[model samples]
Target: MKDLGLIPEGYKILVTATVQEEDCDGLCWQYIHNEDKIKPEFVVSTEPTDGGIYRGHRGRMEIRVDVKGISCHGSAPERGDNAIYKMADILKDVEALNANGCEDKDAIKGLVKMLDPKFNPNHYEDARFLGRGTCTVSQIFFTSPSRCAVADSCSISIDRRMTAGETWESCLKEIEDLPACKKHGAKVSMYLYDRPAWTGLVYETECYFPTWINRETAGHVQAVADAHKALYGDKRIGSETAMNLRNRPLIDKWTFSTNGVAIQGRYGIPCVGFGPGAESQAHAPNEIIWKQDLVTCAAVYALVPSMYKGKGDEDVCQFRAGGTDTTSDKSAC
Candidate 1:
């Protein structure tokens, strides 16, 4: 598009995937010039979201819960205590106990989130933000020694999701306060600090995928929606944006993170998520983008270079003539 002069001048545009990796949170900055970075972050990503053109995935974090117990031998069971047996009983007890402290379901919003990879409670983006998915568990497991030495301790890690209205501190508190888990001797503890990955592309790492969420009333989404509506002779078809549906019947975002932390999550760029493959194809066996979806996705991305047509300086993306201002609102832009 640039070689053909399809892209307008006086505008800076950068395109990339959202699969960048990082090991720390000390630095962040993908698009800015080196001398321009005043802050630091860990990573950027470019995972694809099946959501229409504007919606993106949610941010996430992780923690490990270690349950300690005394060990005993299998033979001559009465002589010694069995840590595994205790843990098994505690797990059941944990599963049975209800929310003890916060009884007012009304105080908490939405549904009671059960940890199911199929329908994790944290999957729902907190009602505040639009682009990122809500927090939930992506992985869970326990550690036990081989040969069954009665197992001294146990651990289960939780993959938490973050939404516009949620924070790392709040997440920890929720886990810590689970009445049932605590009764099961479940302590809200972690081997590492609770870390939900930031959703900003403004990290210092080269591995980042900047994210955005343009409203149907704004830039590319509007333009593209307009194009589709014009083609179909109506203004109704798809939601502005949404998560990719997949084998896992959970209401999730892109099931991954992206550099969207900058444009949509930070600096507040009006962004959106639209791409060629279904959420299922991403990171799956024989992952592939359909030729038609590829063509359509290219067409859509091609429009992006010219999507923002307004006034702004070198550091800011210009808003459309009468588009929505997205800086303040995090949940639904």
Candidate 2:
């Protein structure tokens, strides 16, 4: 902070490590008070997006599919309706649902990929919803015991995902679109097991991160690009990253939801996410951030404040960084 001497101290700068709520939004809200009492303008998420700073993701939700059918002995399979078989058929719907695209009301679209090899099963084993509400089916159960006997009943739970402003009902409709879903007599409901997170933009939603498309003429991206130029001049490329990653064109959103849920879902604060690591390193065994990249990130984290020559105080907090950026340096105040 001393290095920047950045902003005048009269206002206030409360650095927070945790953007989401360990408590309710109320506690985070309390810190926001301009009166040093309650309510903050917005929050910044330090989660990684390569080196690019991010604003937010779409919201997410839990979805469940339960199937009930009668059971019969192995020899007399025709005697009872097999719940397991019924569910197996509906499972096709789940896959097929992803083969198609979901129309999103928000500008951000299709976050949950049904085709994600991770979500799809190798053998397509059916499952039921555990308490976690993960669309990823954790468990599948069939009543009536013995292997020789047919399943009396069964339930497959799915961890359904949604974008900001999406609901469990809408997600269900997506599933319903599949012909197999209809043929299998699949029934979808939140009560059976579903709870969509609030679509509120309190923080970044896991559903979708509002995309930042950099234009040649530009605004924030251009100014930041210029900041790097001013610091290192034309000889050195700006510290900003271009995500040369092969996966960059593929996806920016995470397959699983992030802590964005707690802040965006529970609280009502606008947020942007930026960090030094890739989505893969997080929560994995060999988590690591490159030293050079980490250093570059540190530089930006330090320099972003001064990069912008704002026309007004309101612009002080607006930060924009890399990805498809195309602008020349034009020194900021």
Cα lDDT, all candidates: 0.42, 0.44
Question: What's the lDDT for residue 94 in model 1?
Answer: 32
Q: For model 2, what is the error of residue 123's alpha carbon versus the real structure, in angstroms, after optimal superposition? A: 36
TM-score of 1: 0.59
Per-residue alpha-carbon lDDT of candidate 2 for residues 189-256, written as tens digits (9 for 90 to 100): 54321222244334222221111111222233334444445554423222334344423421133333
Candidate 1 stretches with Cα past 4 Å from truth are 17-51, 76-148, 162-164, 184-257, 261-263, 266-270, 311-333
Q: Estimate each model's TM-score.
A: 0.59, 0.57
Per-model clash counts, in order, read 46, 27
Instruction: Indicate the TM-score of model 2.
Output: 0.57
- Global lDDT of model 1: 0.42
Candidate 2 Cα errors over 4 Å, as ranges: 2-4, 18-38, 101-139, 161-166, 176-187, 191-256, 261-268, 283-285, 305-333
Most TM-score-accurate candidate: 1
Which lDDT tens digits does candidate 1 get at residues 1-333? 787675778655565332334442212332442345533211112245442443444444454555665555555456544445544554443332322222344333221332222333432333233333233333444444545455666665555554434444445566555544455466664333223345644333311222332333444345544443434323222222322342331112354555455545554444445555665665678876555555655655555555444423232222211112332223332
